[model samples]
Target: MKFWRWLVILALYAVPVAVFFTVGVVVVWRSGRCWWLWWLAPLCWIAAYLLTRTWRKQLAPPAETGFVSPGHWTPRDGEAWHVVESHRRHVEDIAPGQLTDPHFYLQSAMDLALAVARHYHPKAKDPIGSLTVLDLLAAAQLAIEDSAQWCRQYVPASHLLTVDQWRTLGKTPAWLSAASNVTWAATVLMNPLNFGRYLIARFTTQAATQQLREHALGWFYLYFVSQVGFYLIEMNSGRLRGGAARYRRLQADLQRTADPPVGNEATSAAVTPEPPAEPLAVRIALVGQVKAGKSSLVNALLGRQQAAVDVLPQTKQVQQYELRVNATEDRLVLLDTAGYSDAGATPEQMREMQEAVRGADLVLLVMDAASPARRADVKLLGELSAWLEANLHRKPAPVLGVLTHLDQLRPTLEWTPPYAWREPSRPKEHNIAAAVAYTRQQFGTQLAEVVPVCTDVARGRAWGAYEELLPAMLGVLGEARACALLRTLHAELDAHRVQVLFQQLGRASTGLLRAGLAKLLDAPT
Candidate 1:
């Protein structure tokens, strides 16, 4: 019955193909001089191949879902980054048949694990052997969870799909394939010009399918590497010391740290894990020239007088204040640095301010809206940006320009509660608007946003702190959280390295003592 069905399909397909072949022969025989037109078919095929190659190079495969962002997951360490990138290139250039092997993904995952393990644990003969069974299981568990989450989110009704159903979906029906070929041949035979079109279409379809398959498989390989590599990094760094549960909890916390709450409270609460006992602290550095309202802004954020505000450069040193921004309980540490000189910061002061900025997750560049002098502010900000750019390991903290003393801008006495600086109508609003624009122009991309605020809450002049500044802070909290996580990871890596060094020393000393004792006892006996 199957043979008969295939025979019928071949008969249907052969009719149109035979017609096309006959027409080509007759045309070529009659028009001997124009027979060179036959070259067009091969040329079209060549063009199709070129186009497919171009697409293959241009198109990147879709990355797996549920993994942390590439920027975050990708190693900042030079040696580690090189290893992952090399693996990626290897995958891209992989043999076509390798995609179909059941163990291809496993092998790729193992290779990545071993490669990264060797880099981290170079002394070990079998780097992977150093990992505890629990560590390996934990890493595998996280990878599986990530893949499962991706399937759940992207593949609709995935749970309903059985093994047979999945296999059926992957396969093309033989009857349908035969019918399609016949239909395509008929389409080409109906018009001789369609011969070229037919060649191009066939080549394109075949090339595209091959390229798509390769890219899709390549994407999965890279995704597996990224997932496994990320957890491996944590394991090797000693951050996963508490076991799989602890690692998973840490991962969930990092996710929450990086991805801020979206949609309504119920949805956010449902998706978000319970607040950690010690929420990751996102440090915000308030930096500007003397009397730029740095302390006042800090006071406003904290809703109390924590940092002493004075006319004669009150904050002589970098002071940190614990702050809880609106809505989320993610701890924010506000760093109020010593205000710099109006002309330009001293080299010593610059070093101090830059150090504070370096440690910070975010920067609040306080500027006096009433005063136009920003040389010191701009110089310091430029230095900080330059420093951040030079440091390849650290993520650049997002900067928010806090334009203070908005009440003292123009129409000085006309302090309105809700001044629409965005689209100004009133004189005070217009002045505030101009200041914000000027600040933005001066800073360019340095500041994410410049918000005008009056932070003198003692004088009943607190505006835009909650409505503008806090919201702006929240807007960049996601990015700030990412920066914070990178810092935490680095700290853990350092601590882990130190711990490993001491452990090796302890082992060496213990071995030496045991050897000496054995020699002494044997000789006396």
Candidate 2:
């Protein structure tokens, strides 16, 4: 494949040189201009041909005779032959047959790790506990550390070869290097000539100037094509210092098995019992429009003011807080994101919020009871719903709709309790009758139960309402939901472990390859 590619490259360069020379000669002869123009045609062709040949020679495979026996080869061939001999010697030094067939050992280790991870995927909901997952992770880490050691040991000697030493050692073929050098020299010389022609075209009146411009453009295009091709090859073939490939593969596998079961709430509840001995820690993200009182609500549930609360939009970035439910003593992480619908927020902010919510085991969509009917609030809700549908296949965590600013609503005068309520200071007549009517009308069927929350930041007494909301929120999630949430969290940890393992493996492979190559080329004959 490499030889054919080189042949095609030579053909491409040759065609252009032949055309330039033939055209240049014909023009010079007809015009009776300076004979130098005619000389240029032959000079360009010879330089181009020689450069191509040098590149090809350098690329040629090293002679096999040097590896078989040094006595049968010339002094120049000795270096090339010694590289292979040295590689074998290095392998023997480490362990007999270790360098010769390292791939089999590496592959076997990878296969074992992969099998272990797979075994634990479904049964061990807590990915960390599974023996297979842990083994895979350890394998990946070991691979990378080994590779680093190998590179440190061998790279210095590999870089010591001079042009002759390199050729002798068969590190790189002489012909290939010569051809590359010729091509590079020609390119450097031609660029100045082409630029000069462009300058002349700008300042002088010459019909040939346009032709020169076209030729320069063609060369530039060819250069760009070559550069692009080189980049593609490098990107595809280059190995990382660490086991990045193995890590990526492991990540892919984990992602496939790690996704939590969705839609079947009943089945999930059955699988995960309410009283798990140890609950997995979970992160929950709360997102909503500005002035929806997200911070105030979180503070109320936490039983402490960990987040800043203000009537004005204050949260600018995602902030996380650890909350432990008094009932279970199980820890839950609450991620409060910058308020949406703020003028300063960009699309990227919205995207970050979306991603935060995507990873959450629960999402709280807070709305203001005072302005639930407002256009901005409605639009925000619709947008959030749309985003959720587009991004998530399963229902994004258990969504709890929180209504804040309940203190502003009038309690009595035939108003609702959960939706509308009579305040404590209402008239004597506005008592149980008003509360009963409000409950019957609003909290009749739609919601499980509505708890009023006063999220007024200045009052400081509004924390009481938040206290009431917490127990209700916990009840809504229940023990079954908590177990599922724990499982999901464990799965994420498992995925991370798998990725780390594969990355290590890739590193080890790279080290082995580099070490083998170095000894083959640099060892003393």
Candidate 3:
């Protein structure tokens, strides 16, 4: 779309140059006004040059806002501007695969978790003493290492891995475990003097309280600083490799089309036809059961009060919300379907609903967290998965299970081994622990991340839990992957245009050079 727009602009500017040159040549040849007509050539050239420069400037990608230029390359400001602008564009149109890059979101979440740990457990120096802090650092480091491996394996010299793969690989429990160990080791090994001081304070001068505070602060500084450095290294590595890979792939794609022209009846007929117009955008449908808090979750994800809710099933039909991420303008077509129950839905209606779920890029299997193992929720999950396998077996989209209504979960329910969901008044620590264990077990291994959300809309507090989970969701969809996908799409569109130009040139009687020149002049600017 942008390329064609630029082509049209360039062609319009070249019109005067073409007309002036033709007129000047005719005047010199027919009227023998050589000197006067020769002057027009330079004038036409200057006009065309100026017009082309102006058009190029207009077509160039816009400069990035709020980026500080680093003085590494010559023309530092220009390079910085271009790099930032290109990255901005890439982010805007990231391919579905790139968004899944585990490193990007995994690192981000790790960074945030580390920040929290540093604040809360500043003095602890080992995983046993400060488990949360150790987990944060370990997770961040592991994510970086895993991401590096992914960069080496799948990221071609020209392109980054697709978002889906990135997310899938990043979320693996093995990666998280490795990261946890790294954090644990770092806390134990670094700055022994600080630990000694903390111990001495504990034993002597009755200043134990003050010494403990100092130790905590010192540990926090060390851990926080390391995390910052790790982020810098990881982000830089991704950018450098990603850029090089994209450039190389672009070259390869271009090279494949550099073959000599073929002239034959069969060859002419062998050309691939143009692709049908793309749907305005991808459409997604959301379906689940009644009192499932589907509407609340939809509102939270969309960041808008678009869906209505009641204690009873307020959503009766397929309600759709077109959602875009705040940071990245990636469109999500959310379809909220009528909640299923044994009583209300007919077989035909059930089949149609199942079809919608199967077609979704992702299905949000919403269930009440307070009632995690309800028969209806389990039935719905089974039905949805069955439909997808039976109908759309070739291309299966991921189903993201969502557990909602956490506030209602009995605070007193004790979580025992072989965890099961139970309702108790004034839930204790055991209950919370058991609930977590049970939820993980029920979901099985393929579950991306089970989110516990509060479904009350008036409070607007339930949505807070989603803040951390949203990035994971976006990662699954490969938000960054969209950039590469768009670039490929653009390249294909240009190749199509070039093929059309070649066909037009073949029909011309003039020499190839003259035809080329005419086509260039007539081509849309």
- lDDT of all predictions, in order shown? 0.72, 0.48, 0.48
Clashing residue pairs found in predicted model 1: none
List TM-score per model, in order: 0.62, 0.36, 0.35
Worst ten in a row by lDDT for model 2: 231-240
Once fitted onto the true fold, the runs of candidate 1 whose alpha carbons sit more than 4 angstroms away are 1-95, 98-250, 261-268, 314-316, 507-525
lDDT string, candidate 1, 1-525, tens digits: 124432343343344456548667667647869655545444544554565565554455533233334334423344465666667666646787887787987787777777777776777566467776656667667668877999999998798999898888777566677887886687567657657766665666466556756766777677666666666666654445545676665566666655565321233566656677777888989888888898898888788888778664544477888986445777889888888779898777787888898889899999999998988787887777677656645778889999999878778787767999898889988889999999899989988999989998878999988888887887787788777877776677566768877998999999999999999989954
Worst 10 residues of 1 by lDDT: 1-10
Top candidate (lDDT) = 1
Regions of model 3 farther than 4 Å from truth: 1-284, 311-316, 342-349, 391-393, 412-433, 479-525
Candidate 2 lDDT at 182 equals: 71
User: Number of clashing pairs, model 2?
Assistant: 27
Q: Flag the better candidate by lDDT, 1 or 2.
A: 1
The best candidate in terms of TM-score: 1
lDDT of 3 by residue, 335-433 (tens): 787776634455665776776764455566676666654566556666665654453212344556676665555642332222222343344434544
